[model samples]
Target: MKRIFLAGLLIFALNVNAQVQTPAASPHAELEQVVGLTEVKVDYSRPNMRGREIFGDLVPYGAIWRTGANATTKFMIDKPVMISGKELKPGTYSLYTVPGEDMWEVVFYTDDSNPLITEFEEEKVALRTMVEPMEMPMNMETFTIVIDDVMADSAVLNILWANTVVPVKFNVMTDAEVMKSIDLALAGPSAGDYYNAAVYYLNSGKDIEKAKMWMNKAMDMTEKPGFWQYRQQSLILAKAGDKKAAIEAAKKSLEGAKAYGNADYIKMNTDSLKEWGAM
Candidate 1:
């Protein structure tokens, strides 16, 4: 009896430790792509055809679909983009679709909480665009979404399932963004920009005259220059073989450094002044 009880206890322990694991019927998939300066992301589940007839049978026509299985399909964009001449702001949205015989309506919804959208809420709809469905020569086993025909300013978002293919074209503001940056750059260099260019030229041994000019402009633009800035100016002047100007700038830097209690700049300026025989 004691042996039988021990055996029973071992069987119970084995049963407790046993676990059954299985693959999901619809597997989750995540896709991310950069369209110019904008980023696009999609998170959804891919359901296989499984030899059953799709479209009009498994997925009924003239009804809104969650666009995927298990969880609501999610679409995210980092920048505003134009789809079918409509603008969509940067955000995460739920993707849905309404299938027809020849056309499909793709939707972007503001609410993305529910796994399945049973009750249709027209108020939460953000954008809806119609796209013509194409028949593919070969069947696609699993549902897939891809960004195809990627260009600098636009891209085609394709949806494939079974033998049907849907393409949606969208445009990004790459040209506008590039033009804005160009305009800002052409406006003029800031004081910090001038200082950085001067320092780079001084360090790179590129045209000491240009470095001297840039450094002077930087100092002129600065209302009350920092000790570090004055130290760099002194170094640039010294490199340009202007000992008198270098000594004058170093003395000003030393005074400012002493006022700011900066030991490193004070030491640097004092050493430069001494090296120039102005100590």
Candidate 2:
């Protein structure tokens, strides 16, 4: 019984010793960014240079790369976007690239379940584009993917490693989205809807008269309007060339702001009142 107990205790000790934790050779990374109205996400692993040659020798010049180490890189977007002038539907995809001396072929494959890609199927490719590689001034140690040069309707997806940088340009349909929202909101419009639509029109340099009308309607529907609401009403009225009404609205906003102890709104209304020669 004593010998059997000793053997069981030895096995338990060995099992505990074998369960050792170690750092990954290539650490995983995830990045998410909002480009215009679209949500872009990337999941991959970053491998270091480790004093080894990267592009030509280690990764090879004319082979399909997973775009990262370990499992294949996953790319996801919430909205449809035009990638390199080609439309790509919203979905998760495996990102792969074929590296060359001057240009690189970037591909988005529909299949994302596979951790490692052993074969490349042409039919599974959703969108493929050739992007020119730029030589960086300094060397980069770890692989990195970034969404850069963001604008209201477009952004650039950049891949960087070693001394090479590849950029892919994509465009989002912001105007289409805004128009759709406007149409839907007008179908069964609420007070908040009217206010939001008015603000959008005011900021986008649309018809100031229409914005003023909508802002007035929004204020009329509310039993008691806030100081900020009165401030927007004043701006819209001023833009629509109703100086007298703008001054009255600003005065009301100034009174409300004073009661609420809001320093910012008070200053804004006071400034506007002075500009309109009401103060």
Q: Please list the residue runs of candidate 2 whose C-alpha ends up more than 4 Å from where it truly belongs after superposition.
A: 1-9, 17-19, 190-279
Q: What tens digits encode model 1's per-residue C-alpha lDDT throughout 65-114? A: 98889878899999999999999999999999998998999999999885
Error of 1 at 35 (Å): 1.1
Top TM-score hit: 1
lDDT by residue (79-98, candidate 2, tens digit) is 99998789999999999998
TM-score of each: 0.65, 0.63
lDDT of every predicted structure (CA atoms): 0.92, 0.91
The 10 consecutive residues of candidate 2 with the worst lDDT sum are: 113-122
- Give each prediction's root-mean-square deviation over alpha carbons: 6.2, 14.1
Give the local distance difference test score of model 2.
0.91
User: How many angstroms is residue 139 displaced in model 1 relative to the true structure, after the best TM-score fit?
Assistant: 0.8
